[model samples]
Target: MTGKRAFVTGVSKGLGAHLASCLAKDGWQVTGVGRRPRESAEVSAAVDYLQADLSSAEVIGGLVAKMDAVPDLVVHNAVTYPDRAAGRPELDTIETTMRVNALAPYELTLDLLAAKPDDQFCSVVVINSESVYHADADSAVYAASKAALRVLTGGLAAACRSTNAAVSTLMLGPLGDANKVEEIRRIAEKRGATPAEITRLFLRRSNPDLVIDDFIDFDACYLSLRYLAELGAVANGMLCRLDGGSAGTLV
Candidate 1:
């Protein structure tokens, strides 16, 4: 499969771009959808980048309509949050974020397979956050959206049972700066609590007890491609963690 077809959303930066490049290197035909296409020579050379406003359902619908075939692999890795702490309307803000995080992915996954309903040609991977567990005061909307996306994952997993395709959920934890630890430290200092007190929050709460892998190395992207590829059609509806452990994990 020199040019195995693959489609990935939110591929302008972060883990999405990394995943796209890894897939390309692994001999897959990569179609990456990004909102604001950037000037990245790496992305330009290896991947076919499509600039589309995924936040708008109509635009997303159009992209879906134009898809050539059911992608052998679909990686849903886009999200928007409510940093609009800047006097934005609450309903619209939440709606837009949820639409990006949850609704759009659900719709896009279905869109990928709709044209060829009988096509059981591959895996659909969803990128989610470890924050899917508990909610902080400031992160209520974000956590809710991810929780809903997980539910969608479960539903889609069930739907794809008879088919040959599979689903993989990569629950990516804090990585690439701008994440937890710091947020927790802020809360700890504000509450006049010790660092241990904040650290305790991550020490396994009842619900998922989701763990965040401390470091994010580039190798995790390659590992994910091989993991999904090795699973073939055996791993529908499975959630895989990308941990940059000292030894690393391989399929």
Candidate 2:
């Protein structure tokens, strides 16, 4: 083992799982936090897993307090969206989304940074979304939350400069399974039109460089994260957008 350590949130699946596993393979001792236990035995074996609901600041604080030492790397990858099936965003939904997507990362980062050893190189990576740039009807609340997170990360970056730490954001486009084709199909049917027509409409509102098929993979996301983590303080205050060539596609 490299004796380097990492703490990653949202490790139950997807990019979180991949990051934890890949980091472990690279000899980092990775502690992964999520709401539920990892279902994959192989992944579970590779990571020291902790279960905690991130929406509660108290719970997040407690989790951090129990750590033996602040990790060298902290990745804020957990995210939640307002239930699009419930129609327009509700007050409660908006609050909950903000708590999970924005507030949790802020709280966790502050807590971790507060405990870091003096002059140690620490890297914080917030997994963000392209939705921060453009949002469809179903994504407005989520986009707002990510926008808040972006600002929070910027603030953290500034605060960390005195401590030899860095904060960066990886704003990503649609992941493999998150392509909104099914959502578009539903909207198309509701509007008495074809799915292709709805897709065209979505395209009009999206970035001109949008590539519908250029969905990102979990491995690629992990690679980008690894790069940032290795850069240490050199990547401070950076917002790296990984849009799979689709810069402003609606999330």
Q: Which candidate is the best by TM-score?
A: 2
lDDT of each: 0.74, 0.82
Give the per-residue Cα lDDT of candidate 2 at 232. Answer: 76
Per residue, candidate 1 scores C-alpha lDDT tens digits across 134-156 of 47777788889998999999999
Per-residue CA lDDT of model 2 for 1-251, tens digit only, reads 26799998888776787788899888998999888755642355678988888888788779887787888999999888877788888897789889989999998899888888887788899999878777777788899999999999999999988788999999887675434666877898999998777766676456666766444667788889988887878899987878855653434
| Candidate 2 global lDDT | 0.82
C-alpha TM-score for every candidate:
0.78, 0.84
lDDT score, candidate 2, position 36: 74
Error of 2 at 202 (Å): 9.3
Candidate 2 structure, TM-score to reference:
0.84
In model 1, which regions exceed 4 Å deviation?
Answer: 38-44, 84-89, 117-120, 177-213, 243-251
